[model samples]
Target: MSYPKDFLLNLYKTMVRIRNFEIMAEKLFLEGELPGFIHLYIGEEAIATGVIADLRKDDFITSTHRGHGHMIAKGANINRMMAELYGRTTGYCKGKGGSMHIADFSIGVLGANGVVGGGLPIAVGAGLGIKMKKTDQVVVAFFGDGASNTGAFHESLNFASIYKLPVIFVVENNKFASTATTKETTSIENISDRAVGYGIPGITIDGNDVITIYETAKEMIKRAREDGGPSLIEAKTYRIKGHFVGDPELYRDKKEVEEFWLNEPIRKFEKKLVEEKMLNETEKRKIWEDAQKEIEEAVTFAKESPVPNNEDALTDLFVNDSGYDY
Candidate 1:
């Protein structure tokens, strides 16, 4: 399928932004500038950028631990995301949630889940809420391959199926779950195949191809918007880094990483854009430069923003509360 020039550019920019942000976050974390366990979404940028490209401001999404890319793709503020990483009060979670639980409800992000498969059930609940309210909004639940093994994933899909809720289950199968490779843990060749048990369409595609991801997800997203039932997508990709920053990663070979790096989504997309004349060397360089600048500014904002007050922690705790408190 073909794409508009601006659409392609925007997709490219999103991927660049995610990659740049991850790189900067890694640098900061290594330099002891940020706190918490950092799960970098470096190699798998296309899945989030492509899937969330056409989502509405009202379309809800549940995120996994490796969720920064998903939030960024869904229009999260770079400054706030950086601040959250920095644990500054100006963050989306007022510096309380740190890297794993940053949320921007204004943009329909439900925040990153620290628990495996946690977002799936949340997405189902949101989908049920949408159905009850009789709205056209849909929910996209992002999870890793490891989450696919959880009871939450199975139960959430069952509920969504029984009710025909507008939810999309996206499995970012990056091969490795934490430090263990899927080859050592998973039994199936395609994780999407499990959707058959729930009576929904399941498809596995190359996660590195941004165009393929965007086109496929755009259709599924549209189908959900039109009240179609949930579908499962298994995006096959390789995790470029160890599970988190500072991970010793004794399980994999460095040569394997080098080979996968050659096939990373950003470089592949950049090549396609250049070949199609939709992007040039100058444009490509500028995209990364602008994103890096934004990252730098976000770092400054996070460093300067005040820390959250100890007593005011109870506020902003509800999804829709009338100041309910203990």
Candidate 2:
């Protein structure tokens, strides 16, 4: 899998952007600038950046609660996203959905679900729609290791297999589902092994390696677009933060977490690029500086945006009849 130098550089830039955005979001949340819970994608940047790089703007994706990276990688405007986090009127969900429910239909983002395993069925339905409409577009469903155990996962996979829907199931096996380690909650050694029951191709790879993820996603996405049916990919990675902001995270040892930092995906990829002569120290610094600058601008935009009007609360709500008795 030979990627062009420009392509590789773009990947690096995307990862850096995601990282910086998450870091800024964390700081904002801690400083009480942003409302609600946020699941930071600090250490898991490579998986989203690499996988999304292979997708077309029209290609659909179902995101998880930890979905900011997916949205950014898929080209969602940082200003709107930051505004949403700030609970401002100029947001993706008009200041209502906050961190867990951002969606851009024009770009094929079905939206991120807060429920565990919630997006599975939605992804399957989207694939069915694409097939019925006779389009070449494919859908990618991003879920965590914990979601693979949910009933929705089984039902969606079975339905996709039986109908030969063009969808890719990406399992981000970050070793833990919330606070519980996956090893204690699941019996299978590999989450991808479950794909065998659906008779779809299942392969697990190093989620930290952006090149590996990019190559694997290219093949699976190509297969789906060609009407070759669905495939499951398990990317073994780790979350660098607690499940949500302010979490105590007593489940794991401090030393274990500290050790994992040494193998952080962003640093590893930066080192590889430098060694391969694709990027110099000055170039890498420029990328980091540019990402930080973009994030700062986004934060400013969010802070300056107005809050949603009190009367506008019922505008986007499902039940619009204010007179209805509860």
Candidate 3:
């Protein structure tokens, strides 16, 4: 697929932003500067950056616990995201959602779920809403290999197919579900194989290759928008870091982690861009430097932001309050 320079530049920027943001978050969390448990999206950048790149502002996406990359890719504000991580009131969820629950409705990101496979049903519901309204908008659900075992994953796919909903189920298979490698959990060699049972088209791609992800996802996204029904795309990739900040790192071998970095998606993509003449070394450095600057600024914003006030704790519980009208 022929892509404009602007698109390529944006994709690279999004990936860089996510990588840097997660890196910064890991440091801050380790330093005890940021509150709560954190799940950094250091390795799964391409899956979100490529899949969501084709979506419009009106199109929706649901995310999992490892959702920072998805939110950043979908154009969620970095300052707000950082503030959420910092547990400040200026956050996207007013410090309530934290890392696993950031949501930006303006960009059609319903929210990120802390539960495994929580996003599948939400994406299916969004697709149902779009179908009921007769709009062409589509919904994309992002989940991990671990979540693929969930009942919601299977049930939602079946429902989407039965109702002919416009939805794309993207499984970012990083090969491990937390500590256990996928080989220890399931019998199927590929998660995409499950799609055949639901009568939906399925495709698998190298998740580390951003361009491959973009090309494969764009077709399915467009088809879903045109009412072609649901599709599942499995992206095979690896995470550079442990499940979350402070993971003991006992389950994985040290050499495996080192090799994952050697074949990291961001590093590989940068190399490809230079080889293809799409970008240069100087430009790549500048891109990374700019990303660092942006992350610093976002951190400053989140740090300066205020904490939620006591009064706000119960204010947004409902659209309207009813007390039997006295």
lDDT of 2 by residue, 178-206 (tens): 99999999889899999999999999999
Candidate 1 Cα deviation (angstroms), residue 193: 0.7
Candidate 1 per-residue C-alpha lDDT over 157-236 given as tens digits, one digit per residue, 9 for 90 to 100: 89999999999999999999888888788878899999999998899999999888888888888888888989998899
Q: List where candidate 3 sits over 4 angstroms from the true fold.
A: 322-326
Q: What's model 2's lDDT at 166?
A: 95
Candidate 3, position 294, lDDT: 93
Which candidate tops lDDT? 2
Question: Candidate 2, 132: how far from true, in Å?
Answer: 0.1
Which residue segments of model 2 deviate by more than 4 Å? 318-326
TM-score, each model? 0.96, 0.97, 0.97
C-alpha lDDT of candidate 2 relative to the true structure:
0.92
For candidate 1, give the lDDT of residue 186: 84
- The model with the greater TM-score, 1 or 3, is 3
Give the lowest summed-lDDT range of ten residues in model 1.
317-326
Pairs with backbone N, CA or C atoms under 3 Å apart (clashes), candidate 1? none
